[model samples]
Target: MRQWETAYEKWKNDEGLDAHLKQELDAMHDQPEALEDAFYRDLAFGTGGMRGVLGPGTNRMNIYTIRKAVNGLAHYLKNHCVNVNDRGVAVSYDSRHMSKEFAVETAKVLGAHGVKAYVFNTLHPTPLLSFAVRYLGAAAGVMITASHNPPEYNGFKVYNEDGGQVTPDEAAAITEAIQKTEDELSVPYLEQEEIEAKELLTWGGQEVDNAYLEQLESITKLDADEQEQTKDLQIVFTPLHGTACDLVQRGLDNLHFHQVDVVEEQAVPDPEFSTVDSPNPEEHQAFTMAMELGKQTNADILIGTDPDADRLGAAVKNDTGDYAVLTGNQLGALMLDYILRHTDPKLLPNARMIKTIVTSELGRRIADSYGVQTMDTLTGFKYIGEKIRQFDATGEAFIFGYEESYGYLISDVVRDKDAVQSAIFACEMAYYWKKQGKTLYDALQSLYETYGYYVEDMISLKLTGKQGSEKIARIMQAARTESFTDIGGVDVLAVEDYWTSERMVAGSSQPEEIDLPQENVVKFLLKDDCWICLRPSGTEPKLKCYVSVRGDSEEDSRKRLTKLKTAMDHFLHRTQS
Candidate 1:
């Protein structure tokens, strides 16, 4: 029998299988493809914790897989954490299907190991979990969420004591511990009654929320009167049937911004996410209801948060009097510009902003104008969060951190993307611009005028199942070996292979070393201040291609973007063929 077949057989005969999962297994008995897919391999725990389609096999996300992952985490914590039983772990969940179940399961596994767990009583944003880890002085934290993935998907993310996602070294240690557990089926968990009797579980509620919101409020750069003056700035917000409805509205109200409207159709917590195809705010389709509401209210801005409320997206009225959703890069630049302008000049010397390599150069330009140094990290926000912790230890300043995927961090209080804080700050930015008799669109244009006109875009090709994974590997390998001197009529100035940690300049015979963690990524630097980057996504089954260009005008920039995108699409897809 094949490896997957043997794994399937083992699972099929297990009497302790979950009833729902058992039924699913029974249904797959005659379906060879389904069986193989489910049992092909254990669900991968990569940049994000293990996430997969919910089903019956080891490779799927069921109670058993959740138990195994938590079991491994418990063992790793026991080894690394001193007095871990008292330090405990913070647990929180979003509104995804089985999210609450996963959170409970995490606590049970911890309880069995005599480790305490401070779990939120209700669904909360991912950033709050980050905050709770530090506020409670826990050894670690787990947030049960899949962020912006589709409704059928759900996963958990691990955070270290510093309230950021676990570092790469930590993840490897945890993975090693997990591999030592030979039998996931028999991993133990404490009963709810036993956990309660042992004082292993404590519920977090309004008090934690108050503490988080209090810190989140500090992200507002404006003073009291300026905050109050934002009342006239009409705003529309939609949580997209996720967790941000109550807290975001309350936060805005606390800022004295009364002209805010919530999209009633999407304000409630929904697991199915019935209103939208996918809950990711990065897509314009996710903002449909909010846009309609903006039109009805003639609102100045539209803001949205995904299921976990860690990523935020915003749209402002353009010159055409229509809502134009700002790309993550554009919004980040706008926010950075506004913050730097208002920042104390004395702090500017010590301040530093961070962004991913794939993010727009406009941010670097804006930071340069303010004398704030900029740092680039790998794609994951964990790297950015790790830097924040390092800066804190070294007594350096971290002003902001963002990525191209609609993720931003303002105050270091919450180490993750922090959509809740970003939403409030975005509103304040719009209000600030409005007070000057300008729209956010105008502010964006002014930024372009000051900086060069930059156009940035991303293309993601979804590849699913085992074959898809293999094909993605082939594409990445092809990129490393393929030779190219020009693309889209632009001469290639350089090539950066992060996997090799080398930069091969056009004329230099020797490759220069890059001082960053090794990852499977490559970048092509073209003439005319244009570039293209390629990498496989850490959280999902997609190969992402990022293209950026700066030109003399908007039209010129867009034309260059189109040509580059066309070239890249052909180059990436031809590998599979």
Candidate 2:
């Protein structure tokens, strides 16, 4: 209680806080729970970076919190760079509350420390920011977005010079710097006008867009004839009132898809995302308006991208005359097959596809059939991006990369998952399928028949607030301590503990090292090509369990999945209790 009082006094006396934060603090002065929630602990920097609810607290995603993060980043950059002033940071944001403000604040903080800042003229997708960082040879990048989080949520993602999210080691160094900054207000910020006077701040525009688009085009395997035949294919797309409107639509047009229909209601950017309960395209509801528009146009395919345009979702008409939303695994496998089949083997003699370990192994089988290599990374797109960066450094060809959570990257143009490129590819593939007198669903069915049936599902258990955080920690600990030899009546062949960087094969004398960076994740490989992974969400207080199974038929796959899900649920309940 005494420590809490002291912290409150310091906050009250702090003159550097924004007026809104001060007001909130005053209103919550008598509310102990609110204050504790707000200041209980500073937001932790994790694999991808900081994300949280938007509010007035150290744990929130407000200007002060953003400044603290930037201050730490600035310190790290200055110390590491020989020419600190010349090394700038690229900034981009999405259509979320205060997203632009956060971008500007980040720029101001960078400028105050004598670092140049290059900011987008307006809200842009997160992947574009990653591209700009490497394109401009900037020291780092900052993207103000929560990816597909709910309306009330926002976040700050930091990228290193490699255009990948800061590696864990780099993040730890930045975290140390942030902790050294005793007061957030002590961090200096340059006024917008002052930054412009010194020409320290630059705006990204058509030049960057042109370069990015050209690179996006290079990834296409479409021939002149294919483009001509597919140009008139009817396609419906929605950005979900996010940042993908212009880039994705224009990319499709460039790909020669002439009959693209944009969902006008969602074409314009809206911070509130008024049309959908959540802007996440993974949810079928996010595509409601677009699906309706698709039906009206008799479109061959419907597509949606999240607010920041880093993730993509699609729906295709099924044999039942109803729209079936394709799972991320299904979409990824389809895209991988299409790209591999269309491209000449000579061009990609060393071509490769990448996906997270928890993603469907069906993709691996598909790649194998095409004589392409498939690599599995830990469960974040950043890991995929890291592999892409490695491929770029070497001479390996990166054909595609995706995760099971609706995020995908089709081209190496942008290091991160790019909905813009995925949108174009999805439309082009839909057109090709339509030319064969079939829908995307039909294509999926054909693939399933060719390969064995594969099924995957995710279960996320939400635990909110501080207590929830503790409980999540306990759950992870319990999983770490326990050894399950069997699940769903199948033998557990091996356990991969990412946090400990160890892979323990059942009955093995010793564990092997898992080369990926350490994170709080565990995966158990079961017999019969089935597996399950458990991890806590980086942005939210939730435990995410992923299950996958392979069977001879769709029905068999469903039965296996049902049994596995039930077993998982029983374990979850027991642990929680």
Candidate 3:
């Protein structure tokens, strides 16, 4: 018998797989490429968790695969805990295909392993899962979401006890445990009724939602009166058919932004995300419907959230009354400036902020101007969450946290990025600007004037499927190996290799430690304040390169960015060739 056929036969003989999966296997019995893609290797567990295309395979995010991951987690918890079964885990999911099912699978696996599980009764946002973990004092949390991925995709994100995504060390431990598990079907799982009867499964719904919303309210700087005056401020919002519609709308209402309008067609939950090609809010095309609604309503601002609603995107009326989509950096800088200006002095001294190193340095300058200390972490909200936890432990107040990819966290109550919080804050900012007879575009331009024209752009080189994965790894390796002396007529002053945790200065043999968790990333700082960073996307088969340049004028900044982009593109193409 052929190798794949024999393997397929063995898999068919297994009793652990349901008829559905067995049928799928049978359908793909003759498809060598599909089988190879399905079982070439197991889906890897990275720092956050395992994420992949959902299908019936060892390599996909199926029930069996999820069960394996949960069993590994359960085993890890058991080994580390004094009372393995009693220590619980919280679970939540977004409005992706099979997200709720995946959450239930996770809970069931935890329950069967004698670990208690608290699961949301319906679709929930990713940030709430983080909040629920800490609120329930669980040992860990699991969120079933693919964030802004296409409808064909889904994922799993694991959080530590502190309510942050799992760190490298923790993820490594779990990955090791997952590797030790031989057969995914062998992992135990409790039936839903049995788990409920045993009192090991608890349903979290309105009670947790109420508490989360209450905590979200506490993060607001605008009072009811301020919101009352600005309540009529016209705003358009779209959740892109994910999980944020109700929470974001409710939060805005509670804040008294009564004129907030939802893009009705896109507001409803849709696993297929039929309205848009992709649900990512960062893309201007994703906001087409929202922008149309904004224009119709004469809305001052247009806001969008990804499927899970942890990240936010905005568009504002420009000088000509046409809508202009603001980058994450622009939105963040505006928020930082607005919050600092209106907040009390007592809040200033204790207030601090964080952003990923790849995020715009403009935010740092804005924070510094207001005497707010800002720190940089490696890419990912997990590091930002880690910083928040450290600050909370040391009595330092967290003013804000964000990444360049539109994720922001305004409140400490939720350890992950909170789009619900961001939506409210953005509405308040818009209202404040409207009361002043100014637009958010005007505010952004003011920020640019003060910060000296900063522009940031990201390029993602997509590699799909198994072959794409190998290419991505090769690209990262190639970037690390190559040396660039100059870019866009600017001399490279330093190269920060995150994987080695070392920064090599120009003309210096010695390297300094970066003092952050080590990861596979490289960043080059140029002499003219232009920078480029290269890193692989954790959730997708892509290598992301970020470029930031600051100039004395907007035109100058654009020119510099274009030059840098062209040079980088040529450089990348040449290297790849």
Candidate 4:
């Protein structure tokens, strides 16, 4: 019998397993495909930590796997951190199935290792988790969420004492320790009562929340009157049935925004996320309820946050009396402009911003217009957060950081992308524009007219299971060997292979070194400053193609994007053939 099949047999017969899990295992006994997929391999941490379908398998996220992962983390913390009993870990969960349970399970595992655990009293947003790490003076942190993934999935993200996501070295060390945590099923999860009695566990809520809320005032540049006047800007807020409803509503209300209306259906947390096709705010349909509420209130803007409230999506009323969904790039650029308007970089000479390499260059352009320097990191908010720590000194200041996927951070109070902060600032931006006799759409148009119309789009091709993985690898290999002169008849200015950390200048044999970490990514810079980037998504089973273009007008930019997408589609598909 195969390794997985043998493992399945053991699971079916093990009396140590929970009856509920045993029943689930028995039902899948006849389904070889299901069993194989579940036990073929353990779900390892990716850019967003270990995320997979929740069920009774090594590959799935369940109490056992959670215990194993926590065991590894406990060992890692012990090896690297001192004073573990004092400066321990801060833990929190989102509104997902088993989220609360996982939080307790993690705390129990830590307690077994003699580490202190400060867990939230209830479900909370991701940013709060980040802040709690710093607020509690923890040596590390663990957040239980699959940020924006479907309800069937749950994940775990670890943070170091700096409140940033674990660095590559940290992840590797923890992974190694986890590999040493043999017999994952035996990893003990102590009872909560015993754990608390031992002083290894404590519940944290109101204190951390009030402190987090108080930090919001630090990110806002507006004074008392300015905040009060923002009440005139009619806006609709939706948490998408996740965790942001309370925090965002309070942020807006505290800012004295009188017209803020939250979508009632989405205000409460729901593990099922029954409102839309998915809880991700990046998808236009996720904003459906918020838009409905916007129309009902005749609101000037609409904002929605994903399940964990780490990602945000916003729509602004256009000239046609309809709400137009703003791309993540558009919103980022707008936020940059609005932020700089309030932040005087002249006095803060070391002020700078950070963004991902695949994000729009329009942000760089906007920052340059104000004499603020912008830095680029590889994809993932962790890199940006890392930069924040590196540059967070007396001289160097972090103005703001954002990703093209609707993640933004105005302050390092939380060392991750914060939708709560973004939503607050976005609302203030809309209101600031409204006070200027302009709509958010109008403000975006003005940005384009000034910086040249910059448009961006992404295409993700899904391929599932083992065969799909092999096919994807082959395509990436083809990209390595193949060369192209032009895409859509536009001459390729240069080609950058992030895997090699080398950039091949156009018409030149020599390659330039790139000062970024090596990853499976490639980019082509075109003659007219347009660009295309290709890479497999770190957190999903899909290959993503990102394209950005800057043209004189919106129509011209759209035409260029369409043509480039067509040619790129043909180009990539040919590789598989």
Candidate 5:
């Protein structure tokens, strides 16, 4: 029998497997493709952690896989964490199917090994989880969420003591330990009663919220009177049936934004996310209910948070009296402009902003206008969080950080992308503009007028399952082997191959070394000030291509982007889907 067949047989016959899971396995026994997809390989625990569809297989996220992943963390903690028992792991979950169960399972796995676990009593956002790690002084942390993925997906994320995702080295060490683990069915876990009796598991969240909210005082730029000035700034917020409802609402109330309205249908935690096709706020469809509420209330702005409440999306009324969804890049630039314009000059001396390499350069230009510096890291918020830690020691303050995927962090209080904080700051920005008789749309257009037209678009191609992974690998390898001279009639000024840590210029025989972690990403800088980047998604089964272009007019930029995307599609073996 093949390895997959043997693995399938073992799972099917194991009486230790849960009956429901066994039934699921048995149901797929006759479907060879389904069985192979589920058993071909272990679910990848990447630089962050494991994310996959929820089911009962080695490649799926189930009790066994959750325990196995946590077991790996336990092993790493046992070897590396000082005072592991006294400073244990903190765990929090979001509103996803089995999110709470996976969180408890992680705690139980740690508890069985005599490592204490502080688990959340209820669902919470990713930012709160990051804060709890430092607040509790835990050795590490785990958040049970898939961020903005669909409801069918859930994940486990590991964080270091500094509340940042584990570094590449840490993830590699944990992955090694995970491979050493065997007999998934035999992994032991303590029950909740036993966990409580032994003081192995405790509940958190409310206290963390208090501490986080207290810290929010220093980050929000506008004061109460300033907020009250734009009382006409009607705001509509929807958590998309996730975790941000209570906390975000409370924070806005504290600021006395009396005109705020929450989408009644999406305020409650619904694991199914029944109100929207997908809970991801990045998609326009996710804003349907929120937009309706916005129209009814004559709201000036609408905000939507994803399932884990880490990514936020918004729509602002345009000159035509219709609302237009602001792209992630647009939002980032707007926030950067607002922050730099209003921040104290004393604070501006060391204020720095961070963004991913794929993010728009408009933010960098805006920062340059203010004489502040900007830094770019690889595609994860964890790397941005790492910079926060470095900033803390070097006397540089984190003014803001954002990714092109609708994730933003306005402060270092939380070491990850924070929709709650973003929502609050975005509200203030809207109100600040409202008092000026302008909308965010007006503010964005004024920015384009000041800075040249800088527009960007991201295209993601979903190629799922085993074959999908192999295909993605092939595409990256092919790009590595071939050298490109230009794209869209623009000369390639330089090329950055992150996988090899090389920066290749046309005349330089020897490539310069990049001061960033080696990863499977390719970037090209064009002579026309346009750039395109290619990389595989770290958390999802998709190949992402990002393009940015600056032109004299919006129409000119759109034309250039169209030609550029065609060139990318041809070069990357993908079409605009």
Candidate 6:
């Protein structure tokens, strides 16, 4: 019998399994392919923690997996944390299926080990969980969410005491601790009554909400006069049936923005996310309801946040007088430009901005124009948060950090990508430009005119199941070994293999070491300073290809991007086959 078959049988024969999981197992007895997919291997847990579809399998997100992960976190904390008994874990959840259940179970698991659990009384956004860790002085934090993933998906993200996602070393240690559990189903947990009696579980949210709002308020660079002048700027906001309606509304109110309109259809907390195909703001389809409302209300701008409110997306009237969603890269440049232009001159000398390797370089150019240094980290926002902590220690100012996937961090108080703060800031920026008689889209055009036109796009190809995982590995290997002189008629200048942390130029036989951390990524530098990068998604079963090109005009940039995308897609398809 195969390994997966053996594991399937082991799970099938266990009479002590949870009732719902047992029912699911019995229903899938005759479905060999489904069984294999579920039992092929354990759901991966790494720096991003564990994320998977919700079901009854080793590779699924269930109560057993959540327990096992929390159990391991508890073990790792005991060994590494100081005063673990007193400094408990802070827990929060989004409006996903079983999110509350998972969070409550996480607290119970920690309570079973005599550690306290400070959990939010109700669902909150992911960034607030990051803030609660430091606000409550907890040892660590757990956010029960899948961010912007589909309704069937869920995740568990771990955070360090410093309010950022756990570092790679700490994550590895936690993974090691998790691997020692022989049986996930047998992990012990305290009941709600038992935990409460022992003072192991504490529920709070309003205080944290107020405190977080205060911090958000303090980060506004605009003075009272400017804020008062911009407060009436018409705006429409949507939370995509997730956990940002209350806080974002309250936040805008604090900013004295009285003309804000909320998309009532998507403001309620919904586990199914019924209105859209997916809750992600990266896709334009997610803004359908918001756009309609924007048209009816004649709003100046439209903003939407994903389920957990960690990513923000916006739509502005284009040259055609229709709502057009701005790409993450374009929004990043806008925020960076507005922030740098408004920040105190004395602070600019010590200020720094960070972006992922795959993000557009237009922000870098803008930062350079302002004399602010720009740093690039690997593809995760955790690295950006880690840099913020480092800069805090070294006395450097972290002005802003963003990813091309619509995640942005405006203030370091909330270590993760905060959509709440970014949403308000984006509105402020829109108003700032409006005062100058320009729309946000108009501002983007002006930016392109000042700096060169830069266009970027990401192609995500979903390759799922065990076979797909193998194919992704093979594709990465092929990218490293294959020789290419040019792509889309452009000469290849260099090849950067992030896995080896080395760059090989066209003429240099010697490879230069990269200053960033090693990751499973490769970049092909092309002529005219354009590039293409390939990396597998850390939290999902997909391979992402990012292409960036510069041009003298918008048409030129779009044409270059199209050619590069066509070539890269062909390469990926050929490799997969």
4 against 6, candidate with superior lDDT: 6
State model 6's lDDT: 0.93
Best by lDDT: 6
Q: Cα deviation of 300 in candidate 1 (Å)? A: 0.9
**Model 1 regions more than 4 Å off:** 228-230
> Model 4 over residues 28-90: C-alpha lDDT tens digits?
988999899888777776656788788998888998899999999888888898887788899
lDDT of 4 at 570: 86
| Cα deviation of 204, candidate 2, in Å | 3.0
List candidate 4 stretches off by more than 4 Å.
228-230
Worst 10 residues of 5 by lDDT: 224-233
TM-score of each: 0.99, 0.96, 0.96, 0.97, 0.97, 0.99
Off by over 4 Å in 2: 2-5, 228-230, 347-349, 392-394
Candidate 1 backbone collisions, by pair: none
RMSD in angstroms, all models?
A: 1.1, 1.7, 1.8, 1.4, 1.8, 1.0
Among all windows of ten consecutive residues in candidate 4, which has the lowest summed lDDT? 341-350
Clashing pairs in 4: none
**Per-residue CA lDDT of candidate 6, range 393-413, in tens?**
799999999999999999899
Model 5 lDDT tens row, 464-551: 9977878888888777767778788888888899999999986679999999999999998887679999899999999998999999
Instruction: Evaluate residue 5 in candidate 6 and report its C-alpha lDDT on the 0 to 100 scale.
Output: 92
Regions more than 4 Å wrong, model 3? 1-9, 82-84, 227-230
